[model samples]
Structures are given as structure tokens and as C-alpha cells.
Target: MKYLMPFLGLVALLACRGKNVEGKNMGKEIVEIKKENTSQGVDTLSQEPRLKTFKGLADTTFVRLADFSDGFAFDLRYATENNFLKAKVYDCAECYTRVKTAKALIAANKDFLDKGVKIKFYDCYRPNSVQYKMWEIVPNPQYVANPDKGSIHNKGGAVDITLVDMQGNELDMGTDFDYFGKRAYHDNTDLPEEILANRKLLKETMESHGFWSIRTEWWHYNLSAASNDKVANFKWECND
Candidate 1:
């Protein structure tokens, strides 16, 4: 009888050990499930859209800005008869700039995004031919740069831009784009605080990214490094 009791105790001990092992296996399974879920979440985040890099591109090469980053908003005025000329001069609406200029712009836009806004382009990389068309319309050096001299825009180094919220609504800069009066001037600070603040953000961010603004137009910015680039007349084809 004593022997039987010892054997029964051994069986009980074995049963307890088996149950402990089963509990450990269940815990391992739960851990594995959690790890798999976490991995899937990371994969989903990695699948988000990524901006293209400028590798293998030359500084002088012109590229469509939209191809590199999807974050910017565009309102190409010359393509839609909304500018001071009241004419659609471009074949279509597309923002193209030199690789170096585009890189600076993308960097500036990232800074703007951190402030809960982004750069919305009014114009970019005007062809030399388009400059002549603008000169013919205005025929005044005060309003339009002569095609013979070539504006910074013709060199793909200049852009006209404003800040806009994530919802695509433009921030007030005191004057509409292409406004030819003193209200559009950067030094004309006789304006509302909000407008000044908006312009300040745009100017500071652009300047930090190697762009300089002119006194006459708060919306215009020229990349300092691209001033020497030869004027380009290469036109982008419109996709029919």
C-alpha cells in the first residue's frame, strides 16, 4: 500500500509538470501572434508613398517636380488665363524646374509642412519663348522681364509660390498673385498681422533653402545657385 501511494504521488507530479508545459506553450503562441501583428503594422507603414531621390540627375537637367514629390499643390496661372495677361500661354499645366532648384524647393516645402502648411506653386520654370509672349503682352520692363535678357524663371531657377493649409486653402498674403500694386510688395508691411506672418513664414523657409526673394514680388523666389544657368526654351509636351 505504501508503494502504491508513492507511485500515485509521482503520477500527480508528472501531471502538474505537463500542465505547466502546456501553459508555457500557450504563452509562446500568444507572443508569436503579437509579434506577427506588429510586423504587419510596420510593413503597412513602410508601404506608404515615398518621395523620389535625385540620384543620377544633373543640376542642369529639368524634371517635372510632381514626379519627385506628391506633397506640393500647383496652380499654374499662365495655363488658365488667370494671370495679369488674361491669356493661357502654356500648352498645359506642369511644374518643371532644374534638378538643383527642385531639390531646394522640396526641402523648403518640407519645412513649410512642419508648420502645418505647404508651398502652392503659381508658376515654375517658364520657357524662354513664354517670356517673350509675356513681354509682348505687358511690353514693360516693370511688369515683365525682356526675353532677350531672360528672367531667372527662364533658367528654371525661379518659382512663384504661396503657402496653403493641408486642406489646400491658400493663406492670405495681403494680395492676390500677380497683383501689380504696392500691396504685393514684400516691404509693404502696412498690412494685417496674419498676412505678414504668412509671408514671413514663406520667406524665411525659402531663404533657408537657398532661395532669395525680390522686393517687388513676395511670391517670387529665385535659387541663388541657378542664376548663372543658361536660359532654356525646351517646352514640356501636353499629354492629349
Candidate 2:
């Protein structure tokens, strides 16, 4: 009987020890699960979208306009063969400009959005090489800028743009882009009322944003502050 009691007590001890071991293992698993949840939370925070800021960037530094704002639309005619050059000078279609120019453009676009329209870009900063290529094709000072002299476009100060409705349809400015005739002139006021009104909206809005229009082309605007900037040859990468 004594032996039987001792054996039973030993069995009870072993059972209690097994329970303790299982409890320790369960505690370890719970800690591991908590750690995994924390890691997942960090990953979720990191994946959240954060807008790029122009806080510390220099005014002359070139940046992709789309990276800073997705509100603007891009056509980038020079990237296609539809331009006056009839050749694809840019490897890809991208809108890059000086930081100051981008800031002004974003502000101007916000104002445009309030009017049920937005600015649509036909072209942005042009590399010096692309300017030379354009000069080679046309070689006309009235149409294309002399590459050696470098236009506002090569200095990241000029943008060819037009207004588009919220539906993405371009507002008529009397003539299509790259038109070199008197019909495309801003001073030619003998057009339809709607076209004149559209041009007025574009010109006033852009001028308020520190941009000035050329007398010859209604679609061209140059940032007044960027006139002294050196011409750039910065190029963008294309996706495979």
C-alpha cells in the first residue's frame, strides 16, 4: 500500500510539471504572435502614401512635376512625332521643371480646379540637345529657338499648356498646338468669343502665378524668375 501511494504521488508531480512546461510554451507562442503583429503594423505605416515636399530643394533643381502632384495632365507632344519637328526627340514623355516653376504651376492648377478646369501640359522642360534637334528641323528663329541661345524651355522655365475641362477635353484656343500662324497669336482678337475667353482665363491665371505669355504663341508661358537660370541637359529614364 505504501509503495502504491508513493507511485501515485510521483505520477501527480509529473503531471503538474508537464502542465507547467505547456504553460511556458504557450506564453512563448503568445509573445511571438504579439511581435508579429507589431511588425505588421510597422509595415502598414510604411506603405501609406506620403506626398513629396519642396521644403529644402533649390529653385534651380529639376524635379519631375508628376511626382509632386497628380492633378495635372500631360500630353508631351515632343516625345511623339506630332510636334513641328516631326521627330521624337525625347526618349520618353515626362514633365520636369525647376522647383519654383513646379510650385507655381501647382498653385495655378489649384486655382484652375476651382473654375471647373485644370491646366494640361503640352510640353515642359526641354533638354538642350532636344532644343538643338528642334532647331535642326525648323532652323527658323520665329518658330524654334536657337539652340546656342537656349530658350526658357531649356532653362526649365517655360511650359506649353492649355486648359482642359474636368472631363479632360481640351478647351479650344482657336488653333492646335505648334501652330505657327497669326491665328495662334495672343494679340489676334478676331476669334470666337469662347476661344478668346479661354485664352483670357489661361493668360490671367498664369500671369498671376508669375508667368508671362509670348506675343506670338498663346500656349507658351515662361516663368519670370527663371530667366537667369542656366540651360539644363538633364534627361529622364524610361521604363522597360
Q: Which candidate has the highest lDDT of all?
A: 1
User: How far in Å is the alpha carbon of 227 misplaced in model 2?
Assistant: 0.6
lDDT of 2 by residue, 11-127 (tens): 999999999999999999988887787777744224655679998999889999988998898899988999888899899999999999999999999999999999999999999
**Model 1 bad stretches (over 4 Å):** 1-51
The sequence of per-residue lDDT tens digits that candidate 1 reaches over residues 1-240 is 989999999999999999999999999998888778777774522467667789999999999999899989999999998999999999999999999999999898888888899999999999999999999889999989999999999999999999999999999999899999999999998999999999999998899999999999999999999999999998998998
Q: Which residue pairs overlap in candidate 1's backbone?
A: none
TM-score of 1: 0.80
Instruction: Give model 1's clash tally.
Output: 0
* Candidate No. with top TM-score: 2
lDDT of each: 0.93, 0.93
For candidate 1, what is the lDDT? 0.93
* Per-model TM against the reference: 0.80, 0.80
* Model 1 weakest 10-residue run by lDDT: 42-51
